[model samples]
Target: MAEKLGTKLNFVQKDLIKKSTKEPGRVFTVKEVANSYGISENTARA
Candidate 1:
């Protein structure tokens, strides 16, 4: 989705997104990832 939207994601964002997909334990939203990682929502979305 980021590729289609042309958003450049950093390593951390990429890792977060990857884990979110593969975990299958709990779903992560932008807000959840941000809170978990202590990052801003914009960074999570990136």
Candidate 2:
């Protein structure tokens, strides 16, 4: 994966990263992340 562009991370982004490491090879989607983290799809997309 490419280096994260942003220096600071939102809660969702941070958790997503943590989840990714725990579940390597699993793919994530905007909708799935948003629903799991209680954020909106737009937030996840950004």
Candidate 3:
């Protein structure tokens, strides 16, 4: 369905968004990754 629309997103990207939108199990805290690795939150999320 997505491929028919000409979207460049692959299966993994689409799957992640669908799963997140459906349940959103965790808060998706980019800050956590940044703090753990000593990187900026924006970079971590990106």
Candidate 4:
């Protein structure tokens, strides 16, 4: 059987990291993060 790649955080995580700063901390919920990056909530958690 072929091996499957593990799920990974999407663009939202990248954007969140970029948007987050020492001041704001860029903390966000899975849903919010998913919506921000146009990905599914489950994918966001991954």
Candidate 5:
């Protein structure tokens, strides 16, 4: 579905997943992700 629409995980999303995998027990909030990526909090939540 997303692929058909040409939608995919962005760099920030990929990096967040990689970091989480590399460090167990790590947690990230939508606000933190948004700040780190310079995106809006709502966008991070989505």
Candidate 6:
């Protein structure tokens, strides 16, 4: 069996953080984030 290590933030989370920092004050909705990342709105909200 293999052991799995958890990460504090996945790629998407890290990317979101980077974007927010660079653009400061910009608001991101679940739908916008989902569309940008090509993920579902439900997943983005999660």
- Backbone collisions counted per model: 0, 0, 0, 0, 0, 0
Pairs in steric clash, model 5: none
lDDT of 2 by residue, 1-46 (tens): 6767565787777888889899999999888988888889998889
Give the per-residue lDDT of model 5 (tens digit) for 13-40: 7788789999999989988888989999
Ranking by TM-score: 6, 5, 2, 4, 1, 3
For model 6, the superposed segments whose C-alpha errors exceed 4 Å read: 1-6
Please give each candidate's TM-score. Answer: 0.48, 0.71, 0.39, 0.54, 0.73, 0.77
TM-score of 6: 0.77
Off by over 4 Å in 1: 1-18
| Model 2 local distance difference test score | 0.83
Model 2 TM-score, 2 decimals: 0.71
In candidate 6, list every pair of residues with a backbone clash. none
Cα error of candidate 6 at position 29, Å: 0.9
RMSD of each: 5.1, 4.7, 5.7, 6.0, 3.4, 4.5
lDDT tens per residue, model 1, 1-46 = 2364225766666776688688877677889888888899997776
Per-residue lDDT tens digits for candidate 4, residues 1-46, read 6554333544555556667864485568888877777889898888
TM-score for predicted model 4 compared with the true structure: 0.54
Each model's lDDT = 0.74, 0.83, 0.63, 0.68, 0.82, 0.87
On TM-score, the stronger of 4 and 6 is: 6
Evaluate residue 20 in candidate 5 and report its C-alpha lDDT on the 0 to 100 scale.
93
Q: Model 2 Cα displacement at 45 (Å)? A: 0.7
Q: What lDDT is reached at residue 26 by model 6?
A: 94
